[model samples]
Target: MERPFSVFHYGGTTSYDAHGGRRSRDIPAGEAGSGLGGGGLHRLHHHTDHDGRPAPHREAHSESGHGWERLVFSNALQAVSIVSVVQCGVGLSNADVVPKYGFGPIIKFLKVLVVQQILWAVSLSLCKIAILLLYSKIFATRAMVMAARIMAGFTAVWTVITVLIAFFICRPLSDNWLLDLKNRNCGNQPAADGTMGVLNMITDIAVLVMPISYLWKLRLETYKKVALIVTFSLGVL
Candidate 1:
């Protein structure tokens, strides 16, 4: 059966044909790739069932591991959507949509927005870390578990560094000896970022290859091993 999809964006609307390919455009109207209708919501149309249903698809079996993996992936996708939407909303809104007559008004609004942005990034990064941990579990080995721990540790360190960057590591704080926590930068950032980048690349290389290597020596299908490696790489990606 053909899948049902109607992506409404730019100046055009597209729907799937019975063969799951493009049907003719019902409307062609704004800027290309705007991902939005010009100054308004775009319209969409789809083929429907007699019961007036729309965009139905196959159901997952309850016992399927694939279904669970999809759930994890989708949860990660949800974080992506939430961050985009919230940031977009803030960008589209005025500093004070209902204006007040003071510097305090704009500053307060900006402070709230900045805090929200940090929260969004932290949540998304943590979700990504968790998804990688799940990937390690699915293809578990002694080395894979170690990789997971190392990745998790990096996540924690990065998160702390992010907090320090956001608050304590400002230029003003840098010169204040009493408040300063470290002489070196708290981030994994090196004096030469390339040094740190190489270290990260090496770690990612080991994490990506080690599990797949272990899986390969087992008698799993070639396709399965390749798929696992590909999906695991996406976590680091």
Candidate 2:
């Protein structure tokens, strides 16, 4: 962790009846650590699962600790969530800083955003990916996973689309300095665009429908099949 250098500000004595004006005390908005507004809502805290992991949960660990895979996944999810929230808060705080200080401070803040937001977004994506992967635990068969992999592929494609739209697609050139002259003119094509949308619909239907289709192979009641499929689908959505 890096510690920032702090400067001391000394204001003159109080001017108000009760030690007097706004100057009598220091008031900072968005109370962070403790007190009334201390929940630190809309802020990014930490992200341990920077690459890939599932949503957080608590699990019993073996004495060896090496077998604690589930515990690692759950803690990773919590970390990812906190980091994302903190990133959002930091972005919002940039606006407050700009009004109070200037672009000099805000520019430095943007640098932090580059690293933090990337990690936060990755964390959120990893959680979703982890949920999708949880399907493997439900039906750990090669054929089932092949179908599930199709679902995952669509997810990856859609994630890319949303990310592109969120960051680079809007302005194409001016708003984003990262884009180049040749790239700015290269916009999305409708034929290519429809593929992702279709893929998404197909994956959703396939993920749920395939399991039900496979129910004929199992020696279970119609009610049991319906119950199992519906309950599992709930987890997916």
Candidate 3:
């Protein structure tokens, strides 16, 4: 008597038979191939119950409970950053006053500039923190969550240090924007500025690259991986 047989059709054309209670054997292409016109085995294996499809580990929480915090923080950062930029532009526009009023007016402008810098640092730090929180919300991997926490800590520390550097760059604190430049002693402003710029870029790059490794490790096609990389790359710009 013939062994019990079953015909399983998948991927458009290919069918499989179970013989002697063993694993199903895929019919070779061109033999019973009449389905999707491709390798029946390929589609069967990849699309078995949509196994190959990317599944979200968690629901995206961008505007729900904790997600609402991310939105608020991001909006506040944008507002503060815009104000700082406008303040800087106004300060620079006073170029004529600098020559006409001597160091006094320029010193006053520097005071305002210093305040703007503080605002910028605060906004930037908050922006990074918000991004990390969003990452933690979307990706459920322990590595991703831990990385976000670490980066948030780094951002907080950087904010504190940069603000302190800005405030104490000039001695007596009041001498920062005062006209008593001849007798006042100020720290290396240029060096501090350069250092902060480098640190800012470094942190930004760190945030941009943080999720790349996790994304690359995912079981996704190369095109999908590249798309994800591009999405994160927007943060840099």
By TM-score, who's the top model here? 3
RMSD of 2: 25.5
- Model 3 Cα lDDT, one tens digit per residue, 119-193: 778767877888887666444347778988988998899889999988888877877776666877888888988
TM-scores, one per candidate: 0.38, 0.38, 0.59
- lDDT by residue (108-203, candidate 2, tens digit) is 443443344334434444544555565543444467677667666766766566556445543543333332346554346355447655765665
Model 2: residue 90 alpha-carbon error in angstroms: 21
Residue pairs in collision within model 2 = 16-20, 42-89, 43-85, 43-86, 44-85, 44-86, 44-87, 56-74, 57-74
Model 1 lowest lDDT segment of ten: 28-37
Summarize candidate 1's per-residue lDDT along 1-237 as a digit string, tens digits: 765666563345666655556654633222322334332322333444555444433222222444454455456656645654453343444555435433433444444433443454455446556655664544333556677777767755654555454454334433322223465344433342454346446545655565455444433456765665676577656
What lDDT is reached at residue 64 by model 1?
A: 44
Tell how far residue 166 is off in model 1, in angstroms. 1.2
Q: Which candidate number maximizes lDDT?
A: 3
Residue pairs of candidate 1 with colliding backbone atoms: 11-29, 11-30
Q: Candidate 2, 167: how far from true, in Å?
A: 1.9
Candidate 1 yields a Cα-based lDDT of 0.49
Order the candidates by lDDT, highest first — what do you get? 3, 1, 2
Stretches of model 3 off by over 4 angstroms after superposition: 1-95, 99-105
